[model samples]
Target: MPNSSEHPCRITIGDDGPLLVEGPVEVTCADGTVAVSDRFVVALCMCRRSRMYPWCDTSHRRRTQPGEKSRRDTG
Candidate 1:
């Protein structure tokens, strides 16, 4: 895992998709709702099609069909 003092949480990009986040982490939604779990390690969905919000449900794999890059580049 890449080490960075600025970001205490450790995040790894998985080969199959989903961001694997480990250690102290907090997730906040646009509606001011927050999800915090201690030693929080979980797979988060990069694709916005999850029925279970904020978590990966393997929806990305289906979404990224032929001619799709499975890229969710947001700024």
Candidate 2:
């Protein structure tokens, strides 16, 4: 069987931020490792630049391109 199972999960997408997921959520790695998060909310990394994989650590706020703007600037 798979290490993890699907269930009803709430998700919120931002125009220029992490994907917010309502937790307690469990995540399993491809190598058979598992990580559990019990926070009321968990932010999933979208820009793939987070040092914390599968989680948001505010890395997305950093400048990525010469003219890139943050959500604060656009919104």
Q: Which one wins on TM-score? A: 2
Q: What is the alpha-carbon lDDT of model 2 when measured against the actual structure?
A: 0.76
What TM-score, to 2 decimals, does candidate 1 have? 0.57
Per-residue lDDT tens digits for candidate 2, residues 1-75, read 122446456779989779898888787755787878988888888887888877888888756575666556554
- Give each model's whole-structure lDDT: 0.71, 0.76
User: Compared to the true structure, candidate 2 yields what TM-score?
Assistant: 0.63
Residue-level lDDT for 10 in candidate 2: 71
lDDT of 1 by residue, 12-55 (tens): 99677688888455689778878765545777778778877677
lDDT of 1 at 65: 60
For model 2, name the residue pairs that clash.
none
